[model samples]
Target: MVNDPHALHHRLVDRPRLTGLAFAPDGTRLVASVQTLDDEGTRYVPELWEVDPAGERDARLVTGSRRGDFAPAFAADGTLLFLSDRDPQDPPGPALWALPGNGEADRIAHHPGGLTAFAAASRASTLAWTAALMPGAKDPDTHAALLHERDRARVTAVLYEATPTRADGMDLGPAEPHTFVLRGDAPPVDAGAQGLAGAGDMALSPDGSLVAYTRAPTSTAPDTNVVVIADASTGEERRTFSRPGHQYYVPAFTADGTRLICQRLREETYDSEWQVTLVALDPESGEETDLLPDFDNWPWPGRVLPSPVPGDTTLWFTGDERGHRPVFRRDPDGTVTRLTASGAYTSLCVTPDGTGLYALRSALDSPPRAVRLDAGKPDQEPVLLRAPGDLGPLPGTLTEVRTTGDDGFGLRAWLVVPEDTGPGNPAPLLVEAHGGPQGSWSDWPWQWNPWPFVARGYAVLLPDPALSSGYGQRMQERGRGQYGGRPYRDVIALTDAALARDDLDAGRTALAGWSYGGYLANCAATRTDRFRALVSHAGLWNLEAFEGETDMHTYFREIFGDPRTRRERYEADSPHLDAENLMTPMLIVHSGKDYRVPTSQSMALHHDLRRQGVPAKFLYFPEEGHGIDAPNHLRLVYETALNFLDHHVRGEEWRRPGLL
Candidate 1:
């Protein structure tokens, strides 16, 4: 249906996307990692662009190559440093490159393996990064020797000694990740440690003397996260902040370097509420002071604003509150205030003086766009920086549907109604279940977006039900231990409430979901036949089967107890137990490489449906994981889902996608 390239939301993947924002220390310019579609349209290529944060002039691309550049960072001497491919033959070299304020770019360092990520101190000359290194290798020569030995021995297999053999991005490697430090003209040093949690968890002190990185729990200590502080130059361990049943990561040094700011979330039972808070660590005394204790905020561990001015460490961070993801500023004197009024924000950066703040804000109807915030103003509306990813006028208008749940709890959802929706021409309803049983429909989504459906004359309802986040832990507690009970009630209750609107058609309705949402979609199909058709993407069918083969076996054990011992809870939430009652048409979507939910869940569901004579179809992505990643695959996803809905709900002829 969205085949036309000029269609409103057809080219969302082809647009020039912006991310990885960096502001120069002097606040003269801001650089961002912009991804543009290649000439062949096979993949997106990254390049560095300078955005005018002050909104004075247009943004311009700074560097270019066939292999592309990304992960922009700045050194204290006004030198711009980034990562790019140094060897065209190798492709994606991820070698460190530096470009001075007024000079040609030159390669600084290229590790044996490709670079995973890199970072530079906000106010210091020291630079540090993480890359793949042969396990147990001490130095460059040692790493090279180990690689040679592996090749000589013809060993190409992995022996599992850890619980997480693979994750979303990479496999458990023959060469593990390691850290490196680069300071001035000196040669880079082997830091003898790993950053553990990507570049976000690593921090460099303002003075550039100390580097702080997080150490993931070893086999012996499997439940705690350790924050390690070390000498930046020598890589000597200085101190550690760790405790059992607690996590301490997202490290950031205050402007003075005397104190370190980080987030800590205690390990609680499966039914307990997870309330992560911001804390300031006394690097010398080893004491932590709660920074945002009074506010209802769950600090995002991925990013924290870095203050460039010394002794004046005013921090800005985004937190989940209700449905909006807004920015909150914490002053040195313990005063906490929200700076942005609305919309979800990420990639927060600040000017050198800490007076100007910059971030990208997005909503259900809009895509991510660069914006500036006044640090001095509280609850200020952000000023648009006018960069790329400009979605021209949408084909729909957005509204919210609010009501009370069966338990007398407040419920809400973002309702996207087509522009032509009216009583005489009501739009068909499509209720989309959000992934992450705990995640809310708070931010903009390029993948699970609603505009495309609305453009096709569908009114989309995105509900934050009992298990969703941003509404305090009690909301999740309401559905915890019983995903199919209370959360399903909230979902259907909110859907019925939305159908009561004049612009929506109650007679024609469908359901679609992924991950945990997919599980709930299956539950809805079995419990009630109100939905004309249901689409489940990577959803769990049998909890008992999924608990053993899924990636996070321990996580499931803690959530519902071991199915081998306490099988009651596992059997209670599983959708397969009630599959005999399913009558609605099902479009089961899954991937061959999905370790999170496993492909077996959807396979079993499709088999059961066919044997029972229930109309069903299974769509598979052989190379994709739990979620489809490639832009080409995503286009197929939308097309296939829309085609299925059109046939089953609208009573039109079913037309399969080309790839199908």
Candidate 2:
């Protein structure tokens, strides 16, 4: 078995990734979405897998098809329902499918623009999902006809009256996303227009009387969201709850159906660190209460899980702290207790009796795997459940490092070093900055794994600098509206501290980052010549241009305080301003469809590097967006990145990446 870090591509491309976990109504069985690369290695083939939560049986495949299935949920009647794009009889678009426990899956309902999300009620067996409805096309048939006509004519241009003309990983809309309800076997019922264009996070009440979802009221500032509660039968809005300058998402109702719990973030600024808190709101009275008033840790910002125990006032959540994303529980009295010790957990599900809690756990050293935890015992360790396959061993080991930043703030980082490195044979360092600028390096990253570099004999530094969560509100506040200031210094401080160790070599080091980290890498290239090489993937170049071209223009406008008024910020933080100072051999990677950072950013940087007579190479992926996902493309990404670092940092002969 090839378990080496450089050979991780083999494992990553072939290994089945588990996600979107859901528990049965009785909690006896668990179903999850397992995605693997297809035979041609062009796209992922997702299938539903069933696992016996009792640990008596190994996980087994439940559903399979070429188009794939995902988002599995059990209806109140023990019928399994999922979203799929596998209807050969019809043109490919996600449609609702049902599995009657003992029979083959059957298509239940079809949506023309495809279903973006789905939700099911636990008690009433009611279903709700979101689908894009084209303007002037009131029904699915009309929308389908419009889509077919557009495709037949090969028309690609889209007319836009909206602020966001396009989005990442999705085509621009001549249509708006609306919610619909599936009732028995009758034709699907239109739930009316969800005023907010792209409504998501649909949740049905336990009694199936109400449907609650989150959506941004306007297209300009799509980040700002509000929760809407509507009558399930008529699809008429009963009430809407939102706080000014706050974003609400993942709204779930309490067992008694009086209150809705959701993750809420107060929009302090455009670039403010998101310190998400769980808030409970009375759907009727619009009264809101912060469940964790004094808790400083930022809750996990990815997917929100429903309350572990129904009818219980206590709520369980996950948060980042120190260097770990741990499970936490907030009692009815607002007292918070930490549960798991040192790993990241997501897709949480609890037994009906609340005795057992199950989640997909992951860490720096491990990929996501099924695990069971004792919900009642906070101190008990989680037991790993049998997954589809096993990852035998790791080629490297991870250690935690701490240092004081320039501003006296404590900094933490995860250092992944190959087992072969020691005092006698120190490894070259690769300082990796995480994205989000507000995000942390607490969890295992599948897209940008560090093992490949370790396998290539280079130590990887995963730093959580200023603007990183898990450190508390103050740590987050330090990087507000100043991405290149404190955060940059924090990363350098940590790198310097790590270099002081005997196992790491300071003379041969490189810096790499993606997204905001990519922005930081660009900033580092201009600010310092400390590293031998640098890699910037989907990084930001010109602040003013980025703000204008980015999908979230309003958010950027708020973050930088209007480029016209804050010209100083735009000039000071933008990497292009200091491009002439870049001295390191840099590799720039970007995708044509990356609307988040935009490919123009990379193109600008490449032009500057060429004009300045700097050694630079641009690896452009026309088919990818934000990040590379296709198997062959991913292989080229890692091989090129590693080869670049080997040539510059390790003084190895340059070998151009294969299949490029």
Candidate 3:
């Protein structure tokens, strides 16, 4: 039950709720992007904040436009390089911009291919970035491209290099695009399969001749055969080593450039069993050794581990192998030493000198706060940094639960019961499923469904079914091809078990999810008309059509199997095939700008439901994409969904005027 507003996880929301925090070149100021949700609820802006580790609020508003800016990096000349969607000439996509640290900024380059600025470079007067090539751009889909697409329409990704200006201050002709694919029509990437694998964070070696990056198998098949290495000077790729059964997230070069230190995920979960490993790579020899192979992996699934101390071979990172993920150090001798011990930590960044560790720490009941960790003694407490506006403790109760599915597989979930739920009356149940059939929602702050549902006298069920991360490798890979088969069965089994209890309202059950969960909701609607009402966000309809339009069609075809080849299987499992069976009145939410699942899927379903005379309404958020980011839009979405559920399920007349 969430009585405290911050009942989810303390470290997740704690003050100086640091995001996109980067250290300046001289380590003078820590630049971070702070998300502030305003009063009107329409404008949620993330402003640039610069704070001196010693507690200075020199935070300036670098981004002045209506569009959001984040992922700031300080260039060699002290100019700030960042990603923004405010380019005057381009559509709503990330573009590289250079802003003077002291004065007004100017546009550097406009990527026609769309922005995927995972990494950028600026040395002397030259500026470079790694991005995706747009369709119909230069011949980027040549043999040397990393992305392998079966069809051009469905292929939305291609690696590119952008050179803003040469070292001589002269504009370097035009952007040079290079596809990482093999030469000459090798075969397009399979649908539902990974084309070319890539690294999230990349680093240019000190010499600038070699590029070091993390290489994970592009496919989501749990190919731990991934590792970080440097591209050879001969234009050949030299793999350092393979790290099977683990994920290598962020990579950085050592000061010497001969070795690479990367943040490796030891487990999918963040709690007691999770571990973050710091591995050292010998680029020249193509060899790698885990500095701490036996280290305990933390429960934080997506948080990046801090790179090892700049010049030191002994890697230092913040992880809680002892309890929660806390700071720890690994000696060259493989002896794992625990660092910061007290509160739960979610994210941290260490300076190049290792003198200070900027961390975001929170307790079970406390919101996360920024702290500067000084490597001294265990008894030495960290210096508290910034304290944003206070959001008093949430009014709720948080309980961790472990439930097993029909297959007897262990499922981990959180049950948030409202503080107002008394012993006599069983609270209405609302089951919230996470997206990313491959993504996990563990230790995540309650922003939308769970929090709001609990506030309205509903118990939220967040079950980490077989496919969710945080458990282990096997758990995540369990429901791969069993999309509508096992996973759906698991959900029903879990719900049935829960409904059997006298504490939950069996007649008022409501199901909700986004992306993959949307697909699941579609399945639930058609497979069984158990729920009184349904809420689907960006739901996927017509998997057959999706295979042809989705960017990763090749990959999807592989997993779901080319629906054409396996038409029977596809139809039998796809919600679109059995849509006629759906009897529940459902509200479908979608963003017109969505590319991952596309708006067409939703449109098709809406039209069909209307034609069939089924109770269905489609809500389109034109100004948004995938998920609603604007505060006003978010409020509208949440309020509309709740009103719909209350009217249809709770038997309450809560619809506002002109809601349709």
User: In order, what lDDT does every prediction score?
Assistant: 0.79, 0.80, 0.58
User: What tens-digit string does per-residue lDDT give for candidate 1 at 210-282?
Assistant: 8887776554565666888888888888888887767776788887889888888764355665557778888
Stretches of candidate 1 off by over 4 Å are 63-67, 89-92, 148-154, 195-200, 299-302
lDDT of 3 by residue, 415-514 (tens): 6777756547887878777786755544334334466666667877776665664455455455656667777776666676666666677878888888
> Per-residue lDDT for 56-105 in model 2, tens only?
78887884432488888888777888888877667468888888767688
User: How does candidate 1 score on lDDT?
Assistant: 0.79
Q: Which model is ahead, 1 or 2, in terms of lDDT?
A: 2
Model 3 poorest 10 in a row by lDDT: 187-196
State how far residue 411 of model 3 sits from its true place (Å).
2.0
Off by over 4 Å in 2: 1-6, 63-67, 185-187, 195-199, 219-223, 268-273, 300-310
> Which one is best on lDDT?
2
